[model samples]
Each structure stands twice: as C-alpha cells, then as structure tokens.
Target: MTTVAARKALWKIPEAMELLSISRTVIYEQIRAGRLRTVKCGRTRLVPDGAIAEYVALLEREAGR
Candidate 1:
C-alpha cells in the first residue's frame, strides 16, 4: 500500500515541469547545474518533491539577498 505522500514524493520530468511552469530545457539545465536533484529508476528520471521545495527556497533566499 502506497500513501498519497509517498506517491507524490517522486515526479516525472513532465509533471515537474508542469508543476513549476518551466520547459523541459529548463528542467534539464537545472539538473545539469546541480540545483535540482534527480534519481534514475531504470530509464526514467524522477525528481523528488524535497528537491523542488529546496530549489524554490534557494531562489527565495537569493532574491532576498
């Protein structure tokens, strides 16, 4: 049995892009830059919810600085 939060913890690339209103290119760029973290499951790349939140927090901190 999978809890809702457990299922939501991992997001596909397209899902993450949709959630963040960003393009595929932007997502890849973030991943490449190490600002966003991802994991590989078979051939699929998955982004964690925590990574997304951390990225947002980093941006917010940068904006504040």
Candidate 2:
C-alpha cells in the first residue's frame, strides 16, 4: 500500500490568506490585533493549523452570541 504525505503543521502568510480568503492587509491586521495566532521561525512568520481552526471557531462563537 502507498502512503500519503502528511499535511503541513505550519502555513506561510500567503497560504493562510488564501485559506481564509483574506487580503494581505487584513491578515496582518488580525495578527496585530491578536486575533490570529502566529509563530516566528527565524525571520519568517508561520500560522499553526490549529490557530486557523480556532479563529474560525471564534467567529462562530461571536456569531452565535
């Protein structure tokens, strides 16, 4: 049997933007506002997959309230 590659644990800014369908400016805004969690790998910033899911859940919670 063939094995499938594992998904990425970290995503770049552009990838996160595309996944969230957000603009570069908006993504930066979220990061600045502490709404979107990200980690720094040297000079590069990366978003954890869990962070994206949490962000979505936050939005859902807000909408439910």
Model 1 lDDT-worst window of ten: 1-10
Candidate number with greatest lDDT: 2
- Candidate 1, residue 53: the lDDT equals 93
| Model 1 steric clash total | 0
lDDT of each: 0.92, 0.96
Q: Per-residue lDDT tens digits of candidate 2, residues 12-65?
A: 999999999999999999999999999999999999999999999988999999
Which segments of model 2 are wrong by more than 4 Å?
A: 1-5
